[model samples]
Target: MKITTIETFVLGERQLLVRIGTDVGLAGWGDATLEHRPGTVAAAIREMSGHLIGTDPLPVTRHWQRLARGGFYRGGPVLGSAVAGLDIALWDLRGRFYGAPIHELLGGPCRDRVRLYTHALSARPEHTGEPDRARALVAAGYTLVKAAISGPVGFLDSPRQTARFVRDLEALREAVGDEADFGIDLHGRVSPHHARRLADAVAHTGPAFLEEPLRPEHSRLIGQLTATTSIPIATGERLYSREEFLPVLQAGIAIAQPDLAHAGGITEVFRIATLAESFDVQVAPHCPLGPVALAACVQVDLAVPNFYAQEHVIDLRSADSRDLRLLTGPEVLVPVAGHLDRPTGPGLGIEIDEDAVRAAHRDDLLVPRGTPRWSHPDGGFAEW
Candidate 1:
């Protein structure tokens, strides 16, 4: 069937959802969330929708290439994420037409379940309640947990800062014991010199990995930092494409964390995983967004052989189940002991609550937000 209309709904604080309506009275949904740039991504979707209306929605790959490479200025967060929203929805449409999950179309399931991990502590580096939070996460049946090092670390902070960073990680490790894995997220706020020091200091804790030690621009230096520490280096929530991820993989990063939303959705992320597989690197998709993106990630995670783990903001099966909000058949995403079983439903395997989505969209219209700004102690601009 032909695509009849394309729509985008900005829900909550930072979610941008896209809905593709077809002539057959079926609608497919996907998340185009770009975090702080919801307006920008929504505009990009509006612009890209011109290429999709009245086109065959089942030719997902053909549409992916045209939308992704159709522009002269190839790839970036905006375009990749925009294409990701449409591409995922196209896959959803194709799956529904065929009565199979996206993974089944991708070549069937590689594993029976997809493992997941969640963040324990706040991004701010503080030891207070750190261990208790770790214990709670482990008690919830999550075998893997992650936390950021600190917020906006100075170029060269004092020894006390390093000590506190180490202490927070140590506390998490101790709380989880040897059975579970603790990951440290550098959040691209730490410099190479300090990243090395932090990695070395926390190496004894046997972290699951050190994520985004340096910003995307400093990818060349990642190998240098990896050489200095034994902790596995994982990055790529910001990289966006396989071309961008090539050098980082060659640099010997043990894990590659490509966000399905930012890395061109299922089509490109599958390619990224295959590329990483050639280099013997694992794929742990970076997903802190909404349920649609999380569902998209699980579809890829199940079909890829090198899949490591999935990152999410909330556990849908737990007491805090905001993930289940505004959706029907969210059971496809509910975690059983930190693992998601293969979804047997067609399409993205979950349906959207259009009324709830519209309500959230109306609320968002009442209060729009601009990009956030932050500053270091010296008053210099800081990364947020």
Candidate 2:
């Protein structure tokens, strides 16, 4: 059937949905929501829809190329995110048309289940110290957990700040012991010098990986940091395309964490995973968004052989159960003993609660402006 129309919907405050209607009454749904840039991304989706209006949805690769390189200037957050939503919807449509899951089309399952890691954000470092929460996560069935250690480092901070960061990580290691794997996210707050120092201090902690120790633009520094520390360096949430990932991977970085929604959706991410695999790099699939995005990531996880693990924002699952309840398939990404089973249902395997999504759509629910500024002791703006 030929494509008929494309519609974009902004639901649940930050949820951006794309519906691609075909002549055969089969419609595809995708999530293109960016944390704070939903409006801009939605507009990009609408603009890209002009290219997809009358095309066949089956040639997914051709469509992806058209949307990606069709433009003279391609591959950024808005364009990549917009294409990501459409690519997922197209894949979902293809799966439904063939009466098989996306994983089957991608050469079947590599594993029965996909393991996941949870995000831990602490307001008060002392109140929610690493040791106390590490035990709780392990007990709650998580083999992997990521914690933000340094809030924001200044250009010229005291040795005391560095000591505190090291102490917290030590406490975490003590709580989890050697059995559990943990990751530390510097959040790109530390400079090259500080990053090197901090990496040295926490070298013995055996972090599964150290993430975004430096800013995205300073990616060349990753090679330096990787050389200095044995810990695996992980980054790329801010990065958009395969081109952006080339240097990072070539630098001998261990993990490539591409956000499913922000990267080029399932279509582009599948290519990204393949590229990383060629370089002997593993994928974690960065996803702190909603259920649809998580479902999309899990589908990729099942099909990709080089997938390392999945990152999830467990808080959203608790806060928006109604939206999450839409996932009622046998292969739903349910956390069982700290791991998620591969989805078996047709398409992306998760259904959308249109009513619930629309109900939660409000201007106030979006991330607020000027939320808070985190700074270092020397008045330098720190990464948040």
Candidate 3:
């Protein structure tokens, strides 16, 4: 059957969902982590729909190439994210048509379950040091957790700020002990000077990885930092395409973290993972968005041999939460002991509750515009 129409829904303030309708009454859903830019991505999808309106959904690769390389200027957040949503929907449609899951269509699963590492809500370094939250996560059966350390260090912060950052990590290490794995996210807020000092201080804590120690543009600096520290360097949430990831990967960065929603959906992320595998680098697919995006990540995680632990928000633990059951049908991403089992249902394996999604949609609910900024005590601009 041919694709007939493409529809989009922006719901829950920042979530963007795409539904592709086909002539055979089979529709597929996909999520794009556009947040505030949902409308922009949606417009891009609408513009590109002309190329896919009458095409067969079975040939995913051809469709991906036609929409991606078909354009003279290709591969950025807007185009990649827009294509990502469509690509996922197409894959889901293909799986449903064949009565199999996406992973089976990709080459079947290599493992029964996928490991996940979720983020804790504590933002301040001091707050993360408390054992109560760590204990709560552990008791909930999570073996891996990540906390944001060093909120917004200036380019040239005093030794006291650095000391506090180190002390915070030290406290968290002491609280969690060796029983569980903990990671620190610099959030690209640290300057190279401070990043070096911070990395040197926390190297002893044995963090699972140092996430986005510097901004995505600082590739050369990231290489320098990677060389200076024993801690594994993880990045790529800001990166949207394979071309953008080449430099970071070639620099010998240990971990590649590509968000499923922004990094060209399952089609390109699978390719990105394979490319990372070729370079002998591990992958930890960045997923801080909704349930649909998480479900998409698990499909890729199941097939990729060089897969690393998945990143999730700790708040998803509450079964009664709206985000927990955002999608309809079976719980595609079931977390157990800090890991998620591969879904056994057809298509993406989880169905979207159209009614719930439509009801959640609100015009006032929109992604915050502009870059969110944070600052140090010295009044210098910091990353957010």
lDDT of each: 0.86, 0.80, 0.80
Please say which candidate is ahead in lDDT: 1 or 3: 1
| Model 3 pairs in collision | none
lDDT of 1 by residue, 1-384 (tens): 899999988885557898999999888889888887777888888989989999989888999988999888979999989999998989998999999999999999999998889878763434422678788878878899888766668888788877887777778888999999888888888889988888888899899899999999999999998788899999999999989999999999999999888789899999999999999999999999989999999999989999999999855764247767878766777788888888888988888888888777843442466556778988998876
**By summed lDDT, which 10 consecutive residues of candidate 3 come out lowest?**
121-130
Q: How many clashes in each structure?
A: 0, 0, 0
Which 10 consecutive residues of model 1 have the lowest summed lDDT? 121-130
lDDT of 3: 0.80
State candidate 2's TM-score: 0.92
- Candidate 1: give the clashing pairs: none
Query: Candidate 3, which segments miss by more than 4 Å at Cα?
Result: 123-130, 365-371, 376-380
Q: How high is each candidate's TM-score?
A: 0.96, 0.92, 0.94
Worst ten in a row by lDDT for model 2: 314-323
lDDT of 3 by residue, 272-323 (tens): 8899998899889988788878888888899999987888762555456667
Candidate 2: tens digits of C-alpha lDDT, residues 1-384: 999988776664456777788999987778887766777887798789888998899989899899888999988888988988999889988988898888889899999988888865566753224567778777877888888765656765578887787777887778777888888887777787888888888788788998887889899778888888899999888888888999999888899999888888888888889999999999998887777888889889999999898998744224335546544442355577778867777888776665655565565534435235886666766677
- Candidate 2 stretches with Cα past 4 Å from truth are 12-14, 125-129, 315-323, 326-331, 363-371, 376-380
Identify the runs in model 1 with alpha carbons over 4 angstroms from their true place. Answer: 123-125, 318-320, 363-372
